[model samples]
Target: MVLIDRIRLCLEKLLEVFTVFLLIALTTIVLAAVGFRLLGASLHWYDEVASIGLGWLTFYGANLAAIKRAHMGFPGLVGSAPVALRASLFVISEIIVIGFFVVIAYYGYLVLDILAWDRLVSLPSISLTVTQSAIPISAVLFILCELLSMPGAWAKMRHGIDSEHEAIEEAIRMAEQDLQESRS
Candidate 1:
């Protein structure tokens, strides 16, 4: 359990750093393209590349949100249920989420296969498959985060902890402890 926690923490930190850098690069790319256009110049690759980067950012951000359990969900019904019912509902919900990702990853590969020989319209040098690979990759990353989160949920359920509030507070406390340690 501790090992899984560490792995999840490590992935979260890495994703945070990656997201920051990705955003910086995206901003620079867009601003540079805009500035050049103001000077009667244009970057032909700007549209396609920026669009690709945005897609990647969105997918990666989804995975990050999943790990944090920050996505919008209406769990009011589950919250009012008995402990066993709540656990069962939670597990069923998780299985559904997992199933969704699995389907995405599976069909995403088939889509990639069909586009393997196709190139981007604006960037002939780049393959369509390369840009579209974000779907499957994001699916895999989301699956990993979900898998890591489940055991903790199981533990919390076993301990009769309030899933909505207590786990969130526990996560925040751990983050603060990590932050304090880094500062010290």
Candidate 2:
């Protein structure tokens, strides 16, 4: 559990940094595009690249969400299940979630082949494969994040803890602690 926690933390940090960079880059590109257009010229690659960046950001952001367990879930429903069925529900849900991603990654890879000779329409120098690789890459990252977070999630499930509520309480506790420290 400790090892998993450490690995998850590391993955979370890396994703945070990468996503931030992607956001900044996309912002800069969009701003440049707008400024250039206002000046009577426009970047041909601006729209395509920005769209690709947005897609990448969404995929990677999703991986971070998975690591933090921030995605939508039915904890209330699962928690309400009879104790005898909770374990089964847990297993079934995990199988379904992981399996869905596996299928996505598989097809995302196949799409790369179909686009093997394709390049960005606006920027012929850049291959579509490079931009589209985010699909499979992020899918795999999400699976990794899910596995890393599963132990803690299982423990919480066993104890009937709602992670969303716990997260809110933790935030309030942290704010109070910060206020106390300032007074001291």
| The best candidate in terms of lDDT | 2
lDDT by residue (40-79, candidate 1, tens digit) is: 9999899989998998888988888888776776555566
TM-score, every prediction: 0.83, 0.92
Q: Candidate 2, residues 118-141: lDDT per residue as tens digits?
A: 999998999999999999999899
- Compute the lDDT of residue 146 as modeled in candidate 1: 89
Return the lDDT, model 2, position 5. Answer: 90
**Residue pairs in clash, model 2:** none
lDDT of 2 at 136: 94
Between which residue pairs do clashes occur in model 1? none
Give the per-residue Cα lDDT of candidate 2 at 143.
90
Question: Global lDDT of each model?
Answer: 0.85, 0.91
